[model samples]
Target chain A: MNTNFTHHQSAHCENGVASNLLKFNGIDISEPMVFGIGSGLFFFYLPLLKVNQAPAISYRPMPGFIFNKAAKRLGITVKRIKFSSPEKAQIALENNLKNNIPTGLQVGVYNLTYFPDEYRFHFNAHNLVVYGKTDNTFLISDPVMENVTTLTEAELEKVRFAKGTLSPKGQMYYPTHLPSEINWESAIKKGIKNTCSDMLAPVPIVGVAAMRYLAKSIRKWPKSKGVKVANHYLAQMIRMQEEIGTGGGGFRFIYAAFLQEAAIILKNDKLKELSFEMTQIGDLWRDFALNASRVCKNRSNVEDVYNTLADQLLHLANLEEKFFKELKKAI
Target chain B: MKKEEIPQDESNLSKSNVKELCYATDENGNYTTGLSTGWEAKTIALESSINTINERIEEAKENIKSGKASPIVYFMELHRMDWPTLADYVGLWQWRVKRHVKPSVFKKLNNKILQKYADAFQISVDELINYKGA
Candidate 1:
């Protein structure tokens, strides 16, 4: 591990890495501030979208959206590269570290040797910072880790070039330029306005609107595909909600936290009220995930569990709908 | 999202191994993060995933022993996937993947296809073909 690399466990990886790298470049910001100013919180329920043929239920924006958007908003120019060859990617990272610059990487989680077997999955958007190297071992600062870790160059290449499902394609990054000063007010307003629009977008498979559709669709799963398949969907949702690492309540809680921070930064009292409401909704999501897991695990045939889950989701949909509306008005 | 909800007495989570960090308090009332350790429910989920991995590894061992498949079959199983999932990874049709699952067909696969599968498993092609079950 590099003695100069400061590692602190964070709630989410992208925001964490973004925050850390920015800090290293002489900018002071918290993860929640980065997430909020970037408008990282979102709820997307796409039944037709499949990751490995499993329904994609994302609670945040896409992989690069948070960091890229956050950087753009803060007028920070980060050197982003998508390499065509693993050899070239390896050399670029080595050069950056040689220059005493910390580099950020988008890596596959499944093959990283340092990750606990339990925490490892096939996710390819995982981010970490490579700070220093001794011989062949590259010191790593995965934002989610309690301490700095190390990975061999070979192991790092394996995951950096990890294939299948959102392949990393040897992508890595480091900050290039920092604005003399940031216009926090404009950025905060823009983030809130864009998030409100995204949440309230008039579409069937997106935003708060999709939450209603997901509830309706979930209720119909048993009749359409039998109890076994319905349970499968339930299990998938639970994993999407819980096991995806750092995304508690599918990221509702983090977003609520962001809102809490935004409220203070922007000095908007209404945003604070809205933050509390969103936290309650996040808690409800946790409750729904818990209930669904119970029903699925116990093989409960009591249809009430399913009904309650649906109702809870619908309640969430309603809550978010009201939230975005009020949020738009507040701004 | 707290120790109360997570199992307190988890054997896997000794205090020294815990990761400490800050968390937002949502409102400002009860919201400071500290030397929090691993969560109980998260541990259970991890244990379950490990169980799934073990089951798949076991099944692949039997398949390898039976010579119904190449060692690549074991890596697919290690990823907790089936033929279709592997097919999806390599962009090969199900029938092609099905055929390649057999040791005979896998022997005939070209370096390109082998590379594809190796890339999917995040291992060298040789490693994919030489995986020994633990």
Candidate 2:
């Protein structure tokens, strides 16, 4: 905010990007002042974004609880590591490999403590990977990320590799560039990079949940064959959700809920046909998410998802209106 | 220097003879009051400097209106002026802004600017595709 202090510089201003950290007393300072100034600027420019981009500083318990409940209802295991150092992060990757977890995991190292004066956070997913070591100093590609970037010979030499840990999980990996691979050493020196890590279930459990719910909702009205059609459509959605991950996770829930609600209201024949087509849409949503979870984390993914959902909603806008009307009449 | 507008104090600061204006001395050997340090002369110089800065700002604004000026170029031009150079002490604008505005505000502004460019691109793309059919 106060560029007047005395410097010319472009900084990575967000997502744990560290600018020059100045220390006055023995205590470390800089981040607090920067955030304060940035927040002040945000107030001045609120009209510019039209929508406010400020995120709440404190963590909300409700959303996490809701997600946890959803996960449990769908029978998927959810795990979180609040703050893992480089060494500990490496260990998590190693454990995933050793256990044959069959799930893809990528670790990101955010702010790099270069020199005390010129530290910057690098959020490039490519650079923040965990590479396996062959012997004393050889590099190997992580199995989950094998399809992505293959390490070149020169890259291996420039990036320092040290062993790191993830306590409890206790997985191991080459913690590139840290002086000591031990947890305390890595934690103290490098400073922790605030990165959010999420893991997808080995298989699409959400898909299973959707299908099970669909089957249960329709079996009551076996003579109402339209329910069967809806189940088929929902089954496809579940499959896609399982394959894709977080990208499709939100929409999968919304659509699955819509279908479940629809079965209750619609007549037998109409419900059956609606279910069949919806199941396909569900599958598509899941595929889009699973195939593109990491990719969707980018800004373009936001635009793509919004546009796709908007277009689909437009297509069904009339039908949706009719569904409401008929349900009201029946009641 | 305008014939009708010249003040009577002009003779002290801008006399016809350079000797009185540049080297006038008092009885005590200190320079006389009316020559170099007169309030009238100070006010004139301040006015002229302000006019020059205002003219420059006007030109920059025109350039920006025409879509020919870069924000960085205008910002740097504003930077070059001294505090007293402008009529209203416009350097204070930057100081006030620097003190009040937050870094996130600047970032959001930059993003909004970028989004405008993105919207412009989207419009052009739509036009291009639609026109091709015609």
Clashing pairs in 1: B7-B40
Model 2 C-alpha lDDT per residue in residues A77-148, reported as the tens digit of each score: 445442235455545544543543211222222122221111111112212222333333323322111122
| Per-residue lDDT of model 1, residues B2-65, tens digit only | 4234323342434336453434352334343443454444444445445556766898888887
Model 2 chain A weakest 10-residue run by lDDT: A192-201
Residue A286 lDDT in model 2? 32
User: TM-score of B chain for each model?
Assistant: 0.64, 0.34
Compared with the true structure, all predictions reach lDDT values of 0.75, 0.27
What tens digits encode model 1's per-residue C-alpha lDDT throughout A188-240?
A: 88888888998899997778887888888778777786665676677767766
Ten residues in a row with the worst lDDT in model 1 chain A? A239-248
Which digits, one per residue and each the tens of the lDDT, describe model 2 over residues B85-123? 211122234443342123333334444443332232223
**Cα lDDT for residue A3, model 2?**
13
In candidate 1, position A27 carries an lDDT of 85
What are the TM-scores, per candidate, against the unseen true structure? 0.86, 0.24
